[model samples]
Target: MKKILEIIRYEYVTQVRRKGFWIGIFSIPIMIILSSGISVLAMFIGTDRTPVGYVDHSGVLASPVLPEPDGLFGESMEFIAYTDPAVARQALLDGAIQGYFVIAENYQQSGMVEYFTPDLSYDMVIGDFEDLMRHNLLQAYPETVRTRFEQGSNITVRALESTQQLNLDQWWNLVLPLVIAFLLFILIQVGGSYILQAMVTEKENRMMEILITAVTPTELMVGKTIGNLGVALTMLLVWGLCGGAVLLFLPAYALTQVSINWGVQVIAIVLFLETLIMMACLMLMAGVMATDAREAGQLTWFFGLVMSLPFIVITSVIFDPDGPMSTIMSLFPFTAFFVMPVRMTFTQVPGWQVALSIVLLAGMIALAVWLATRAMKQGMLSFSRKIKYSDLLKQRRAA
Candidate 1:
């Protein structure tokens, strides 16, 4: 136990001291800060809001009443009435306006209006002008009709015979599950890579032979796994702290809008931790079989793709959380990490199913650790060559 602790301390200290590790740790927060700063700067340094011209050939809007300029929203529209189309074209050429609108002579009857702009891709500008025209047209209607149009219609949605009542439209609830799943995926992949790299580096340096003289294969494997796990957890802790800070500083209205279930969150965290452990063990086995970092990376990426297959069908899991497909995915050890959390988030899963998934995942983790330990023992002396899966099993039987 003391030797294991020593190994953990050595691994942690050595990794933490590396410039790459520290750079990775702080990169995310730095990016967030820089993004926020750019946004704030852009708010102060506003974009140019060129005036738009209009030509009323229909004679309907001979003397139109435009809204007063409100600096809070943006620059007010400057309308220039032109009777001749040739004069309007010359004004546009002179750069007197950003765009021009031409109302047809039969505009009131045909409801046809033409707009000319150098850039047609300015959707926001076009949309704003359309909205302004619509509002003005509505104002010319009867008072009752104008009031009804302005007030708009109300819609109230109610769910009947529902097992779970969650607002899927809410930003946090919609995003949180995916965020958690993605984070778990990153943690497993990155932590596993660390284990693989460490093992390969030690082997290349002939440090494994020296370590073998001091500790058993099981201890070394367990120590390295636990050490890397600690590193991953530390990263999670730092990110959690940053997230907590954001939550603390967030507006009260934003907090009220997002409804979080603590019970579900706790369960998800446990499942994520378990998934990481299993991935770490599997990566250890891959590292044992790999002769170099290049081979280790290929093997790790292959496992990553297999593990990420659940994400491909995430849309199905979200829409039909309790369907047969979701059930099978939740029960399967490879996919359960992503599927189960999504199931728990959007719907109410049965207790038995959750238990079964947990048991299956736990069993897989144990089996993975056992296989990894055996592979490490056998492959320690067999360096610069790949370890066959069949040989490992056969050797276990022979032992």
Candidate 2:
């Protein structure tokens, strides 16, 4: 136990102290901050709020100019009415106006309005203009009708089981699952690769033989796995802290819209832990089976691809969480850790299904660890050649 702890400590400290680890830990948040900064800068710096001309052919809209309105992103819009389309076109050509909207003579009946702009990319400008036109149009109606139109419909989406109404604007329900799955996918791919590389390095340097002399195979495996897991968890903690910090900047209403189902979150954590264990075991086994890093990389590529399948099919799971394909993916051990958590996020998953999945995953993890340990012991001395999968199976049968 002492030896195992020592190994764990050594591995953990060595990794945590590395510049590459710290850089990786900070990279995501830094990139997010930089990107956000660039977006804000672009929003303010390059965008000009030039006056927009409008031609209201409808005789009812007699006002020569509409009131200036503030845009969603703080840009001011000035609407100037024109008597003729030719004048508005001339103003646009002369750069006196950014764009123009022409309300047809039959606008009251046909509701046809045409907007001309040089920049199609200014979608927000068009959207804001549309909203302004909508408001102006609504003013023609009675107060009661205008109020009802402005208030829109009261849509209440209730769950069949609990009869609890869900908020349509709760964007977190759509976003959180994908975020969690993406995080898990990144951790598994990166951490598993690190474990594979570390094991290959140890084997290449003949350090495994020296280490095995001091500790049992199981102790070494457990220590190494725990150490690497600690590193992965540290990265997760850093990212979590950064995410929390970002949430602080969000509006109260936005924050309120983020509802967390603790049951689902707890299950997600469990699935992630199971995934890490399984990946670590497989990485160790891959390392044992290979004679060098090249061989290790080649062997582990298939496992990496298989692990990424969940991420590949995340869209399908998001759209139909309780679909047949999703259920199959959630129940399958290889894809369960990613798919199940995502599925749980979008819909209510049955307790029996969750339990069965957990049991199957736990069983597979135990089997993987056992196989990894057996392979390590058998192939530890056979460094001159690669270990065959059949040999490992035969050794298991003999044991």
Candidate 3:
């Protein structure tokens, strides 16, 4: 136990001293700022500036059907009274108007209209205009008449549901889940890669042999894995600090409007720490199987992909947080780290599930650490070109 603690301390120190740790700590805020800035810039660039001319041939003048114009952010419409449909079509052909609106002789009865745009942008504009026109037409009718029209239309709402009250400061609930998933994905991938590389580096350079002579093989392996975990924790801390600072102090748009509870923040921090510990155990298991840097490199992506799969399936887990399948995933050591957080975020996670997940995770970590130690003690001693899992298993069986 003392030796293990010593190894942990050594690993933690070595990881914190590395250039990668420092680089990661500082780069995250820079990347976040740059990404946000680019998104805002794109929104501005995509906004329309051109004015559209509408030739209302059937007396449907620009009432509330036209979208409100806001300079470059919106499209303005000009209404030109046309004596005949022929004149409107001619005007559209001559580029006298961006698009021409033709209402049939009995447009009120036909309930159909045609619009022609010079380009696709105008096509969108025409579609939006049609939507607005339909909205205004229905709204103009009596409530009973509008209800009848809606019943006849058979329109069903999809994707959009209940409207949320605007509490701008509470935007964390909206962005936090996505950002948390992204952070977890990144930590697992990058931290696992560090373990693989470090293991490979020690093996290829024959440093493990020298270290094992003074300390137990388990100590060396456990130390390295702990060191990697330390790096992961440090990264999470930096990202959390950056995010928390931005949330509390920066007051940027949607973020500014929401109030954040420190208690919630503390819970998130604890959960994140638990996740990192679980990830460290898994990384140790993978590192034990890795013979060289190349093999470790190959396995890094594999483990990352496995950890990442749960983040992709978060919505499914949320819809049924305690369903049979979700229960299985939540209990599964490989998936629990990612799945548990997502489930907790989107749904009301039951106490049993949380307790069971943590208990199962703890058991898995203890078992994995034991297996990793046994594997490393057997495998790390072999000064051969290739390490075999069969040899490690044989040693463990004999022991």
Q: lDDT per prediction? A: 0.77, 0.80, 0.63
TM-score of every candidate: 0.80, 0.89, 0.74
TM-score of candidate 2 versus the correct structure, residues matched by position = 0.89
Candidates, ranked, lDDT:
2, 1, 3
lDDT tens digits, residue span 1-399, model 3:
677778777767777888877887678768878898888778577644344444454455545454345444454545555666677677778877666666665666775666766665535456545645565567667877855664454332222332212233344554665576577667766676666666666766777778778777767766777777777777877887877787677547756455343433454454455656656655555555667766655544655666667667776786776677677776666677667665555455566777777777677667767766765765564445444556657877898
Candidate 1 residues lying further than 4 Å off, grouped into runs, are: 29-48, 55-88, 103-112, 133-163, 319-327, 396-399
Q: What is the Cα-based lDDT of residue 70 in candidate 3?
A: 41
Give the winner by lDDT. Answer: 2
Which candidate has the highest TM-score of all? Answer: 2
Cα lDDT tens digits for candidate 2, 26-127: 986688679979998887776667888789887545643232455446555777789889999999999999889898899879878888888676544566
Worst 10 residues of 3 by lDDT: 157-166
Backbone collisions counted per model:
0, 0, 5
Tens digit per residue, CA lDDT, model 1, 193-232 = 7788778878777788899899877778888889988888
TM-score head-to-head 1 vs 2, winner: 2
| Comparing 1 and 2 on lDDT, the stronger one | 2
